[model samples]
Target chain A: IAGITQAPTSQILAAGRRMTLRCTQDMRHNAMYWYRQDLGLGLRLIHYSNTAGTTGKGEVPDGYSVSRANTDDFPLTLASAVPSQTSVYFCASSDSLRGDTEAFFGQGTRLTVV
Target chain B: SQQGEEDPQALSIQEGENATMNCSYKTSINNLQWYRQNSGRGLVHLILIRSNEREKHSGRLRVTLDTSKKSSSLLITASRAADTASYFCATDNFRGGGADGLTFGKGTHLIIQP
Candidate 1:
């Protein structure tokens, strides 16, 4: 139970609206990531933070933003919601950026844009 | 862009049989990892293999990594209905100076008929 926790298991938003998905980890991990899972696209990384105060973009970063203000929280925000952005979002954390580290994931947030 | 690609997007097998999934990547990786996700749930870490490691085993799961060929495989022996899920292969690549994140491939959906 001492892993990642994501808020709002599911949400429905209107087009052009803004939404923020919350993620927190109790493991004190140094690396955190945000990914969106779609039917045929699999999991695509949106943003990542190697540590607190540092953030980097992943494969698909457009229209999404993330902030790693602290070690325990990494929040992903969508500036303007769109139908194409509707997908399940997951949060993951690892001990470090080392190659051998294993990542832990959250239950995921299912967001639907209408 | 997606760095890793999984083969045989979907597979069906009978219970107690074995299941195998393959993944290939486009770049040099520091490590490769396998994860499983049950329907409407979070992803669970199955195993991790470093660039220098050839194979690793954990319980009923086996993972093989061939860095030279930039491919990896996961084999599940004596599979059960519980083994039915989406399996994904992720790569931790050496991105040269910026913070690194895992690049995931489209997962393989395994169905174990009971």
Candidate 2:
């Protein structure tokens, strides 16, 4: 099983454009997350889903949106891309919300907003 | 913006030596996790330690958590060239199901010398 798959391994977008990053996991994990990693900065959560049909905002949710339409899919969308939005995005999933639950991550999508 | 902070932004160690990285968080957490990331890739889960546990080990990797001090340490023994990567510590916020995302640290860049 492909644990987690992120589409368009890398992309280049112009400023003020709209872009969607796709993420899918075969594990059917209950929780899914979207995070962006910037140079010299930690991976900051952009949005998350506790389960299918439920979505929530994380620390840095501004300028981004997410939807958990089904157990296998959780996509992140950028409304108006800017240089600040240029970063590597990762999708992760976990079995449960309990303590010490291990998270599995995707390969990542490198987006360059010019 | 960032929940965890890692010490020694960069480290250089001989191939057979050990590498230790420390992380500190400001809030109470259910679990602390360590992840590894190559230069421009998704972070891979390494290990996790619960608040009630002081130490845990996996193969050549050892992790220690001190809830009283809200900190954790990750030790990798007998490092190899393949171990050259950035290490990050992530935390599960105490606020239950809503905090579905994991907050990560800036990360420690470990370089293994051949």
Candidate 3:
């Protein structure tokens, strides 16, 4: 509704193909995050942006990259998708640093790599 | 090792029963948050308890935090079939003044039978 909006909903990508999962929030949040959820592995942080013009690596940021060119959008990209990267990806944002504010999340994007 | 880990991995209960889930984290956190995910849906923030606070409640959900133990528990009273979902606890922290993001647990899959 008035919160976060994700694109595609789901995607099927071939291994070695490039892919980008889009995330945008109308809340004008300063912090945005990307996480991958896998069975038994929990949710692992891939990338995050504390504010516009600044981005950083998370717990697991090897194959994923993120950019926050503006306050409203933070898109996650995979240079070359891999099967291991095939999982449910979630995008979230908070008005302040995650440590101090509650995060609002996008519906999620289910990705499968073949 | 995961920054946050949930216990019991899965739980089952009948309608009108109470459901409890626990989470443990490794580092000092600014806050701990509980979220719910229905199947493949995006996460919905249920509650957030700050490091300085011990407990918080919203509607039928009650959350308790023990900073000394680095643990937290969520209790849902008089739960219903609509509560069937994966419940996760996330710890918000800064690593070396960087890597600002929430580390989530594997989560507990709660099933409320009708």
Top lDDT model: 1
lDDT of each model, Cα atoms only? 0.92, 0.90, 0.90
Clashes of each: 0, 0, 0
Q: Residue by residue across A1-114, what tens digits does model 2's lDDT show?
A: 789999989999999999999999999788999988888888888888988899988888999999988999999999999899999999999887454587899999999999
- Candidate topping DockQ: 2
Off by over 4 Å in 3: A97-99, B95-99
Over the stretch A8-111, how does candidate 1's per-residue lDDT look in tens digits? 89999999999999999999988999999999998999999989999998889999999999999999999999999999999999887444688899999999
lDDT of 3 by residue, B51-112 (tens): 99998999999999999999999999999999999999998885545447888989999999
Off by over 4 Å in 2: A97-99
User: Which candidate, 2 or 3, would have the higher TM-score against the true structure?
Assistant: 2
| Superposed model 1: Cα runs more than 4 Å off | A97-99, B96-99
TM-score of each: 0.96, 0.96, 0.95
Question: lDDT of candidate 3?
Answer: 0.90
Clash list (residue pairs), candidate 2: none
